[model samples]
Every structure is written in C-alpha cells, then in structure tokens.
Target: MCAPKGAAALYVRDGLRLEPVVHGGGQEHGVRAGTENVALAVALGAAGLAADDLADGAPARIAALRDELHQRLAAAPPGCVRLNRPERKRLPNTLNVSIDDALGHELRAAAHGIAASTGSACHRGNHTPFDLARSLGALRLSLGRWSTADDIETTADAAIKSATER
Candidate 1:
C-alpha cells in the first residue's frame, strides 16, 4: 500500500502526471476514478507540511543513527552479517542487511522490541534478491522522523543478539 503522504506529495509534485487508465469523473483531479478521498488527502497534506518543517535537519540526524546501527550490526561475529545495500546508494535512513544462514523473518522476530520488517510483510516472506540482495531474508530497518540514537543503539544490540543466537 502506498503511503498517503507520499502518494499525495507525488500527485502534488506532478512528478508524473498520473491519470486513470479507465476514464471517469474529475475525481482525484482525473488522476484516479471515484470520489476523492478528501480526509486522506487532507491528512497527507498535513503530513507533507510536517515533513517540510523537518526537511533541513531530519535526514542528517536519521542518517547518523542509521550509520551507527550499521556499524553495530556489521560488527557481528565474523561472516555472520553483511549489509545488503551500499551505504552511499541508499536512502539516508534505511538499513537493509542479512544475517548469514538465518531467515530474515526469523531474525526480525528474534529482535524483540525492534520494529522492523523482512522485506514487505505483505509478501509474506517472498523476497526478491538481486546481485547482493538477500532475497526475502534481509532485515530491513528504517529510521523514521522520531527515531533516536538510543533507539538505534537498542536495535543494533537486539539485531546482534538475534543474529548471534542462530
């Protein structure tokens, strides 16, 4: 499912002049059929405004925390862990890594109290693996607006503990 905020922003940005494949009323400004989801639109607009307020500092802060998390996770015993993506090529606040010989879902489940996913939860564990991708077996940790250094620390500790356990 698309994030309401991101979907709305993409629409507002005219990033891609989206239009319904099937013709319909002027709903969603003709981008989508059926009546407009006014409540969700308004909420998305509000989220956009809130994100704008954090545009300057949030990314850097989150990146730092993410990097710290990566460092901790990377320090896992020997060949037990590996980052799934290049740090420079990824979004600032996302960390995707796989624990060797461990199922992503299992690892995530073991990392108690750490909110994370093994690819898309909707995929039910069917993850796609590219070159270095871990298929659906990489734990995806995303640091968001309210994530903190302490949270990263806790997550790192939990991940290490979980991966080491297997």
Candidate 2:
C-alpha cells in the first residue's frame, strides 16, 4: 500500500484539451470527476520527495549488486543458466535468465525464497516473443534498495542448485 504508483501524477501537453473517459460531477471543476485517493496521493508526493533526496550513487550501487548476482549465478556450469539479454540494454535492477532443461515456473518454485516470475518482466509488456511460445524457461530477478550482498549470494546458490538439479 505504501507504493503509490497506482494513481499518481498526470501530464497533459500544452494546448491539448483531452476528454476524460469518465464524465461525472467530480473534482477538477467536474472535468473527469471522481473521488480521489487522498491518502495515496499524499504518500506518492512523499515518495517522490524521498526519491529526489536519494544519493546519486544509489542506482549504481543497486546495479552493482545486480551485476554481482549475475556473475555469481553465471559461475555455474556452462549452459545451466543463460542470460537472456545483455545488461547494457535492460533496467539496471532487473536480470532476465533462462535455465537449461527446466521450465521457468519450476525454477521459481524450486528456488524457494526467491520472489520472481516465469519469463522476463518484458514478457508482460510484450518485449519478449519466445517465452510463451516455447518452454517458458525464463526468470526475472528484481533487485532494489533493500537487496544486499548476502541476498545475492543466497539467490545465486539457490538458482544454480535448482537449475543443476536436472
């Protein structure tokens, strides 16, 4: 609930008069009127302010942890785990991989504490074409502000073990 991205700010271009899908007696002079989630709006504003105050190096640090996790997982025997895309093109905090001889959902279940989903996060956004049409042997790992080196180590070990189980 603390994550306020669900309903946040909206930007309309200058000289653009857009029509709202829902027209009712509401806020903003009744232009697309609806009851707003006041609490969520306040939390979103607070989160934005907090984000602006974050250290410039925070993203880089998280990316480093992401890279380290990939490296540790890659140390597994060749072909056991495959990086689906080059890191340079992806969001620094998301890693997408496919395990040999195993399905993505299976890997997810076997990895235990790791929280992830089958295929890449891109799959949900239509960025990946092969996941649904084939074996679905893809996994997406997301790292964030709270991720630590120990978390990376544990994740890598668990994923490798799960993949190598064959």
The number of the candidate with the highest TM-score is: 2
**Backbone collision tally, model 2:** 0
**Would you list the C-alpha lDDT of every candidate in the order shown?**
0.75, 0.76
In Å, residue 17's CA in model 1 sits off its true spot by: 8.9
| Model 2, span 1-166: residue lDDT tens | 1356675677776777777778986676455677888888777767764464255666788888989988887778664667878858677788888776678888889998889877553447665455553347788899877889999998988888888885
Error of 2 at 161 (Å): 1.5
List runs of model 2 lying over 4 Å from the truth: 53-55, 120-135
Clash pairs (backbone) in predicted model 2: none
Superposed on all Cα atoms, the candidates' RMSDs to the truth, in angstroms, are 4.2, 3.1
- Cand. 2 Cα-lDDT: 0.76
| Candidate 2: worst-modelled 10 consecutive residues by lDDT | 126-135
Clashes of each: 0, 0
